[model samples]
Target: MIINPELDKLYNVRAAIPNHTDIFADWEQRSVEFSQNVKGQLDLRYGKGPREKLDLYLASEKNAPLHVFIHGGYWQAMDKSQSNFLGKTFLDAGINVAMIGYDLCPDVTLRELVEEIRRAFVWLWNHAEEYGYDQGKVQISGHSAGGHLVCMLLATNWLSYGLPTDVNPIHSAIAISGLFDLTQLVPTSINAKLGLELEEAKLLSPLFVDPQNICPLLLVVGSDESSGFHQQSDNLSVGWGENFEQLDRMNAVNCHHLSVVALLAEKQSSLFQWAIRHLGS
Candidate 1:
């Protein structure tokens, strides 16, 4: 049976054009207002290039665990400000939240974007102590494209950065409706902007990567999300086996990709509670 009616709306390789425009506009407006509410020091740095600046929202407490959240938009859309709503959950839980912004695709390659995220994580690691965060207690979470990035971070070699080989910068990862494999999207028009080749797709897919580290991972997906999204989560879970733990799926009570963030904003939600428990431990 058909699972995602929204996916049915797309006539060709292109996404449902109208929905894309509407969602992006909503994100832009939300991000603008969210930026205004940020208090304390906000560090903006061009870590990789002219456009590659990381925007960090520091919480009032210094000794709290840090939650690094990455935005979605299929790796081509969305901005850091659009995801500011996430700050409320972790902040209320007595944890500091870091929202990351990366250059969108078609302008910069996905490989470059992934590397940029890696660099941002390193920046966070180097500055963790100064920021009053426990580098050992860091948690990484992302939605959609961000979710893909979270998985990529999990697969990285911590030893290469002079960090402990046993130390995974990301102690726990909360990946919501993440796309783990780029190969599935090759047939879609997103590939036009993503510029994915077969070889590149295989190399970048987190599902294909080995999961040797045993980090607790929480994979969440809206019940109403597309079949492709569900498949992505399933593939990652299968690939990681026991290294992935505390797997929780949320139907989100009538939520879509955009609406899921509202659930995340609710500190009492399963996703938020699970993340807090993991980060606290």
Candidate 2:
């Protein structure tokens, strides 16, 4: 194995330490408060059973595209409330946005979390008219773990769930800093708490799965992210080939893992503009 000291340092920060809860407390607090002010119906029910709530943020205008955002906390941390700030930009662009929350790992298996996301999409599809969405214009975007979920949604077979065979809930996807290959993470400390085995890792990996029905996808990473992250993005784009239609891999200059999200708010950024254009088309 080739070892680059600088690359190793980037991947080994204190935040990379396993099960570090307090590292993101401040940002989480800010996101919760920001979500509260967006003004929309909250925790609308999808499943009849417990733990089936989803927060909705409707656009002020009618017939808007619905953007569903999933927050990233390595599948063990963060909440929907902490990602409320994300809806504002889409809302401003006359698009509705939904920030979904799911049960975290250890408390719930990764398989369960994936089911929750799938249910969330089902709910969105069933209630698209109520939320002023076109249903056909829905898009999925997420960061890190959220990114992985979005890709999974893209790969899901709608026919198996009784939905229209050609209907993909996600018209396009913007996956930022996603972990497409879970096998590489199996040896990491985080895998212990996640309880991920080699077989499960391959099964859950978006990279390993056949990319048969993907929409236009944008794979983004921070210019300053670790080599592992950079590699993951490259691998997914290359693996998908034609299925990864209109691929745009961006390197947000001078940005790091956390700060790179700011580019989403900057309407001028190529990534942000590309997303808007895709949704508009």
- The top-ranked prediction according to TM-score is 2
Clashing pairs in 1: none
Q: What's each prediction's TM-score? A: 0.87, 0.88
Q: Which consecutive 10 residues in model 2 have the weakest lDDT in total?
A: 11-20
Q: Give the clash count for each candidate.
A: 0, 0
Which portions of model 1 show Cα errors greater than 4 Å? Answer: 1-30
On lDDT, the candidate that comes out on top is 2
Which digits, one per residue and each the tens of the lDDT, describe model 1 over residues 178-266?
88887776666567788888789888989988764467888887766666777788878877865655555555656566666556777
Task: Compose the digit string of candidate 2's lDDT tens values, residues 165-211.
Answer: 76666788888888898877776665756888889998898999876
In candidate 1, position 178 carries an lDDT of 85
